[model samples]
Target: MAPPAGYVNVRRDVTDQFYRYRMPILLTKIEGKGNGIKTVIPNMADVSRALNRPSSYPTKFFGCELGAQATFNDDTERYIVNGAHEANRLRDLLDSFIDKFVLCASCKNPETELIITKDEFIIRDCKACGQRSNVDMRHKLTTFIVKNPPKSKKAGKGRKAVAGADSIAGQPGGGKVEGEDDESDDELTKKIEAGAAQVMSEEQAQALIAQREKEDDWSIDTSKEAVAARVQSLDSKLQNSLVLEDDDEEGGGPYETFGEWVKEQREGEGVTDADIYKKAEEMGIAKKHKSLVVLVQAIFTEKIVEEIAGHVPLFGKMTTSEKHQKSLLGGIERFVGEIHPDLIPSIPKILMAFYQADILEEEVLTQWGTHVSKKYVAKDVSKKVRKASEPFIKWLAEADSDEESDDE
Candidate 1:
């Protein structure tokens, strides 16, 4: 059976007739044209309210998935996404977003609250199942959610009235009536007397302290030299313990060692990409996928767009298969998204650099551009990186289309 005229079941996969969670169906309008094209969701606020999330969340999710810029105006209650998108396409994406961010992982219940922990982790606390689950911190939206946490609902009028009544009853004689039993007054008097009785006299307190002092041994030496020796011994033990723990926690893996070496080399004078490759070869992880990721992350700086071309030979040798290509992309994502977000807007140029160098193949770039994943970075950062690469991806698609047209 079709859903009610304007609202649909929040969990579309659940076809139960009485499933209570329902949200207004999404409505979208395509506005503007060409470079300025955008899709506007006028009812975004209502839909988000029903989902118990901010309107900007779904709006931004659409942008991330579509590689478009999403913006929301709180005053106007308008959510807009760059580029023309159909309602059905957006609705499908919204379902995907809901599955990842909204529903309870254990019970699939929609009655869940997004909680941000002190350590900056996102948790979905479910009211229905009484379970708390962590949200995937890799998603780009987690950053947004952490910054703009859900607004707690204010106390209702009924609650306020009850609180007012309690305040009045708390005052002296506020709740008393003529000839009332006054059981509460009697209980309060007994509590006060019991508390008074538990207090000891000054003589009894002095006796207790004297007894404790007599019971405890105080035979240790009090000489200044003895105290200094004890302090020195404790400091030595603490320093040794900390050194052992630090050594135990240190990473001795090949990738970690290689990353450290690269960082050291980068900080020093005249360290070329070839030198980095040579170091990776010496460590016997030159062709490893993860090594590629580490190399990209460790070697690059803010001048990645300008510097990437010169390192083509090194990347060309390391990036052998699709896996290596993906690792390379992952490394770039971490470098740009986490380490140097100021270079986010330069993502397209970076991709083009890799493409022209033949370091990253068209197939891998296309697949990477279409999907947003948290394998490398937070989902939102991945989306932002991809959105910035939309121009290049679109060009690649159009070029392929032109080639097909020529064949015909």
Candidate 2:
């Protein structure tokens, strides 16, 4: 059967696959008192899921293009742009977003993922053609994308190895083995000495030696005696180069020391969750700020998922800003997505608890819910987290509708 007139196939070109992938047409309803009026996208979540994007991306795009503020209230599933807009106009504007953010540049297919590089450039990775096209950074959406990159397709080590091989094959004298010819020690020593002359410093020589050792691993003798002798020789050279440290500390720097301190704190009995956050601040974890999210992940275990309601105050104290909120969300993603995927069913309950405690606002949750980042977790884990949270997300949206009708 044909999809409703208000709905369209995500891959518009694939008319035959209508039933396979369909999304409702953009819908808008303007509501509020004077000066507070806003257009609400009632089905924004459904539309976003169909396009495989965060609902906030398109909602934000609408606001940016129209020069207005946008708000996505997860509690109510109310996607609001701070102005009156026609449903048809939004539907048309959505096509522009799909063209820029959704469609693959090469195949024009909608099967694409959003990738944000470390340098803050956005890339549209097409699943169909396997082409990665850089998105124009001039758009306002780029900043949001950097903060909330979509889940990427898992490219295992095999793909990376194949790519590395391809690059190597493209280089000069690419595939041929180096130093294959039998050369006498005297001649090889002369060549090594000549190469060493090009080495500018002791650091460079150390690096070179490390590289040579790595390359020689397979060819080197693995017999127990030979291995032991090689290890002893290397250990002797390393000891000669080593600088002694004070007895007060071990070999590592401040970060490692801080990590050890945190571990010690975690091991202490009768310690509360609040005590952990307080200790983190005292140890300047709060000052680092960047490390707070990582600490959140490490601090919370799978056991917390079963009792998230009690930990609300801890999360509330920890998330002092948006970055902290993002980090906390990232931590949750890792804990549930990777470590204990079986606890996926508990996500909605945890989120509601966070919401009720005022630890996370609706806007924050809505924005966080849309993204699947590998920043705090593994790629596969991020994917699993998102998959597991879908039902809870849908329920959250409908729960909003139910509350609205009751108010009416």
Candidate 3:
């Protein structure tokens, strides 16, 4: 079918008039005069819907390329750039955005879904060629995409419909039988007969029981001593599993040495948190903010939220100001978002744990969650970690509101 008038192929470079994927033509209106001049894309919502992207993305892309401020009003469905831009020129720029972010690199098809991975990478999953292509992370718009992820459509009903089709395909005639919907009673009778035919006879059931008895001869020794021995052996294996190079004699700095030493002590046996503090003191970095960051990344594991209470005294002794608290949060961002991303879902609980222990202040937590940064991890990873921490941040805001109400 032809794409009706006023629509163009999504890939504008392809001159195929019969292209199935099409979007509305770009439209721009110059508003205001001189210094207050702006270009309003009145049809941005329709165009973005056709391309399966948020309207703010391409609008922000224009802002980045033209060095202009772009504003999008979701309620009004209006996208405006802080300069006069011709519709033809904006259309050319839209083509560039489609090529980079919409079209599949492998098949050049517009049927692609944007996927964000746990490690903070943007991928374009193509439905045409079944290829996953990486998006250029250096682009400024990718940061915005990460912060505002696309809403995914539910597939449960579609999957059930497909399953019903597959069952029909498996039938003898490869189609639904006549009057199938009206034969519910007959269908129940047939199912009962089939179930009866599959039942085991007395002799077969006895044989099966005998086979099960013959295969159940093994037993495990779960005595206290045996369990303790197994645990000790497992601990020993875990300790020797990771090999850290001795960078101390190779001109590594005090923070590096302290981090490595903390990792070593965590892996080895019989090293208390007090011993770690004493070692840090001996190295003259016990109160350093960088050392606290290193200690956070090195000592904690996947069970950080549960185990953090035990080390509160050590952290309390080191963290004196907001700078130290910010450093600690940076360490956690690297630890959970970069090193062990399986802990990403636990980020809110982890932040709440820190807040309850007085390790992270509410002001700092609110500030950190407000924006995404690439200081500790990749920008995408920072966004994911912050997104996961939204629940705790919201709770903090509600608590503050309640306090204000009580003061009134």
Candidate 4:
């Protein structure tokens, strides 16, 4: 009876229904290439929330009913099946899942909680009617529901405990000695030890020294400390295949100087968000789009959500190109990673802010989500950021689908 975007009353056949409770329509996206091709159900989480069940239940049911492999990528919240399927067909199939697992047998109400006893019995505990009904345990989803049980209130409190531990674990100083704060010192010591080991192979080491001596003509420092430093630098250069350069004398490296510039601008007046980029361009910082990402991280403080929302116009202007969109994603990854890794939970809100601002389009985000990269953050941080962004990414896909439907 209402617009179908946010919440819609399910199915047309329920003529007697007067309830205001509603559920989102099923939205699916086809993604990947060749053998990697799959149908991604983006709104499974919201639908499952409406049905009072784990998101995986209906996803697995779709796979079983469709006779295809369903994989729940928990990281991306992209519940994908191994084949392409139509949205209407999947939506109809979801009604079946609701009938079976969601609705209580006695009261026929969706206000039900799944209960599993030590005897491995699957029971639906209805809060509305106080009726307990045993669900048929024959379905494959029962085993999954048992293993991946619903998170109880007690578990919700325990999440705080986990968060506390993660805060300590996420820091670079997580595994450091109590009093040792200098990471550079530890790094230098390790490099020296590694260089000493490289000097062990008599023939190879002699050959390298001979070559260096011939090239330097003994004009360079030949002392033991100097030789060891030279060996370490050579090994570092060979490993990276590049030399590390200092910040530009003009304005300094983008990251090294941008934070101060941002602080100065934030304290000043009449500087619109786009003007920041223009200023960056004047300093040659915007020449590299990746530098924009670094500048983004430098610009924000702990209140990243508020900062991003306030600066939406700036992001919208910069994110016109695919490269800039990808860089914005990378910048978000870095900002959350170093500033407040605990803010990983706020990824969905951040993404929604960008989406509402028209900074990140669904197509660009979907393309970026299909791959995993550590170009901007560490592998672990990358994984956490990706996992945190799952819900928002899924919502974007559904929103895009709804727009397409309205267009058609």
Give the number of the best model, judged by lDDT.
Answer: 3
Task: Compare candidates 3 and 4 on lDDT and give the better one.
Answer: 3
Residue 15 in candidate 1, Cα distance off native in Å: 1.6
Model 2 per-residue lDDT tens digits across residues 349-393:
666555544455666777667777666566777767777667666
Steric clash pairs (candidate 2): none
lDDT to native, each model: 0.65, 0.56, 0.66, 0.58
The reply for model 4, stretches above 4 Å from the true place, is: 1-255, 264-275, 402-408
Better of 1 and 2 by lDDT: 1
Give the residue spans of candidate 2 off by over 4 A.
11-21, 151-408
For each of the candidates, give the backbone clash count: 6, 0, 0, 0
Better of 2 and 4 by lDDT: 4
Q: Candidate 1: which stretches are off by over 4 Å?
A: 1-3, 152-408
Best by TM-score: 1
In lDDT terms, how accurate is model 4? 0.58
Runs of candidate 3 exceeding 4 Å displacement: 152-408
Question: If both were scored by lDDT, which would come out higher, candidate 1 or candidate 3?
Answer: 3
TM-score of each: 0.44, 0.39, 0.42, 0.37
Superposition TM-score, candidate 3 onto the true structure:
0.42
